[model samples]
Target: MRRTATGLLVVMAGLFGLARWMEPAYPAWSFVRAFAEAAMVGGMADWFAVTALFRHPLGIPIPHTAIIPNNKDRIAETLARFLRENFLTPIIVSRRMQRIDVAGAVGRFLADPVPGGRLRKGAGRLLADALEALDPERLGTMVRGGLVAQLRRLEVAPLIGQALAAAMTDGRHRPIIDTMILWADRTLDANQVLIRESVAKRAGSLLRWTGLDERLANAILDALHKLLAEMAADPDHPVRAKSEEGMAELAHRLQHDPELRAKVEHAKEEILDNPAISLWWQGVWEQARAGLLRAARSPDTAVAGFIGDGLRQLGDTLQREPRLAHTINRFARRATVGITTGYGDQIVRVVSETVRRWDTETLTGRLEQTVGRDLQYIRINGTLVGGLVGLLIHTFDTLI
Candidate 1:
C-alpha cells in the first residue's frame, strides 16, 4: 500500500513537471511552474532512493538495488553479530542493568502494599496452578522409585544398631526396661485367679500321683500364689535383673557383632520386599495427598495462612537486610551473566533459526504493519523537505 501510494505521488509530480516545462507562461504562471517542477524533481528523487532499498526503481537492474532480499542472509548474520558484540557484551549489559537499579525497583515494589498484594496473588495463583497440574500417581511412582527404593537398598541395620548401642551405653533404655517390668507385675497381679486355677490343676495331678487328698492340693495352690506375689512385689528380684541383663547383652551383640547386623539387615530387606510394605506406603501417600489437596482447596485453611505468612516474612527479610538483598542481587546478576556467557551462542542461534524458518513475505508484511505508518512519515517529510531544498537551489541558480 505504501509503495503504491509513493509510486502514484512520483508519477503525478513527473506529469506536473512535464506540463510546466512544455508550456511557456506569464510571470505569475512561470513562478508557479518553477515551484511545481522543483517539487516534482524532489518527489522523484526521494521515490528512487526509497525504491532502491527494497528493489530497483522502475524495474531497472541497478547495483545495490533490492539490497534486503538479495542480502537477507548477510543482514541476519550482521544483526546476530551486532547483538553478540554490543547488546550481549557483559560490560554493556551490566552497565545497562545497573543503571536500571533492579534491586531498588524491586524493593520499592515490595514496599508498596497494593503491588505487593497483587504480586502475592499472582504467585499464589501460579502455585495453585502448578499444584493442580501435578499428577499424584506419577509423583507417588517417582517417590517410590527414587527415594523409597534407594532407601530400601541402603544398609540401615548398621546405623540402627549403632544408635541402639549408644542408647544402651547412655542408659536411655533403662526406663523402657523398668516400664516393662512394671507392666509384667501388674499383669501377673491382675491374673491371680488364673494363676491359682493353674496351680490347683497341677496340684491335683501331683496328689493323684502321691495318693494325697484335696487339702494337699489346696496347700500347694496357696504356696504357688505366695511365690508369685513375692516375685511381683520385689523389684530387685532375680527375674528382673536377668531381663535387664538380657536386653543389655542383646544391644551389645547388635552393635559389635557382624552376624547380628546381617540378620537385622536380612529381616529389613524381607519386610521391604513384601507387597504389604508397598501397599502401606501407597496408602499413606494417598492419605497425605488427599489431606493436602483438601487444605489447598479450602479458602479459610491454615495452609493459605501459613503460605501468606511465609511470603510476608520473606518480603520483610529482603527489605530489612541489606547484605541479604545484595547477596540475592549479586547471585541473580551472576546467574544472568552465566546464562548469557554460557548459552549466548545458543540463544542467538535460536533467534536466527526461528527468523529463518518464518515466511519472508509474512515477516515483511508483519514488520511493515507494525512500523509502516512511521515509515510513511519519512516519505512525506522527504517530499516536503526536498521541495524546499529544490526551490532554494533554483532561486540561487537564477540569481547567480
Candidate 2:
C-alpha cells in the first residue's frame, strides 16, 4: 500500500511538472493542466506531512521532520502517559474488567474436563520444577536463620507449658506413662541378678557400720523386690498417683508461675545453644529433606500419585462448587490487581529503560520494514481525493 501510494504521488508530480511545461504548446489542455497541478500540490503536502513523522523528505533536514527519531524519548513518555490515562486508569480498568465477566469465563473454561486436565498437567509440571529447584539446604538455612531465630526470641515457653498442662489435666499422657512404668518394671526384673550382686557388694560396708548380719541384708533385698512387684501389679497405687500428681503440678506451675516460666525459657535457651542438640536437629532435617526429594523426583512414587489425586479432587470440587470457584476467581483477581497496583510503576520503568537502551536507528529500521507497506495507502488516497476535488472546483468555476 505504501509503495502504491508513493508511486502515485511520484507519477502525479511528474505529470503536473510536465503539464506546466506543455501548457504553452497545448492551450486546449488547460483543464487537464489545472487538475494535474492541484493533484500534485495536494499529494506533495500530504507526503510531506507523513514523511515528516519518520524522516527528512528527500534527505533535506527540515525542522520537526524525523520526529520519531528526534523526539523518541518524549514520544515514549507521552505514549506511556496516554496508556496510563486512557487504558490503565483504575476506573477504566475496573469498568472494562467488570464488563468482561472474567470470573464467569474462567469458571466455564475450568468446567470442561479436557481443559481442566491440561491446566492441571501444566500446573503440576510447574509445581514439580519449582519444588525440584528449591535447594533444601538454602531453605533450611533460611528457616534456621530467620524463623528459628525469631521463634527463639519469642517467649513461647508459657504457651508450650500451658498446652502441656492441658494435656496432663486431660490424662492424655497416662497411657504413655503406664507403658514406661511397665517397661521399667520388666527391665528391673530382668536385671535382678545384677542388682543383687551390686547390692551385696555395697551392703558389706553397710553391714559393718550397722553391725547387721547377712540375713538382714537378704531380708531387705527380698522386701524391695516385693514392693516393686506390688507397685507393678497395682496401676492405681499411691506411688503412681503421686507421680501423676507431681507431673500435673509441674505442668500447672510452668503455665501459671512466672518463675517456672523463666525456668522453662532458660531450658529452651540451653537446648537451642547446645551443639549436640543442633547436630541432632540438622540430622533430622537432612533425613526428612532427603526423603521428600527422593519422593518428589520419582514419578512413580506414592507421594506424586497422592499429590496428583489431591489436585484432581480439588479441581473437581472447584468445578462442582460455583461459590468456591467465584471466591477463588475473585481472590485471584484482587491479588493480580494488588500486585499490578504495587509494582506497575516499576514494570513501566523497566520497559521504558529497556526501550531506551535500544539503538534508535536499528529500532526504526525494523519498525519501517514491518509496517511501511501499509502507510503508502495514505499517499494514494490523498492523490485520488485531491484530483476529484480539483476537477469539481474547475467545473464549478466554469459554471459560475
- The prediction achieving the highest lDDT against the true structure is 2
Worst 10 residues of 1 by lDDT: 295-304
Regions of model 1 farther than 4 Å from truth:
1-25, 55-63, 100-304
How many backbone overlaps does candidate 2 show?
1
Give each model's whole-structure lDDT: 0.66, 0.69
lDDT by residue (230-313, candidate 2, tens digit) is: 766786878878877887787677668898788778887887888887677778778776665554455344223665466556
Question: Over the stretch 260-364, how does candidate 1's per-residue lDDT look in tens digits?
Answer: 878988888888788998888899889876665654454234224664456456666777888887877777777777778888888777767666666656555
lDDT of 1 at 297: 52
Shift in Å, residue 304, candidate 1: 7.2
TM-score of each: 0.53, 0.54
- Tell me the lDDT of candidate 2: 0.69
The runs of at least 3 residues in candidate 2 whose Cα sits more than 4 Å from the true structure, single-residue gaps closed, are 13-31, 96-134, 140-309, 366-374
Count the clashes in each prediction: 0, 1
lDDT of 1 at 18: 64
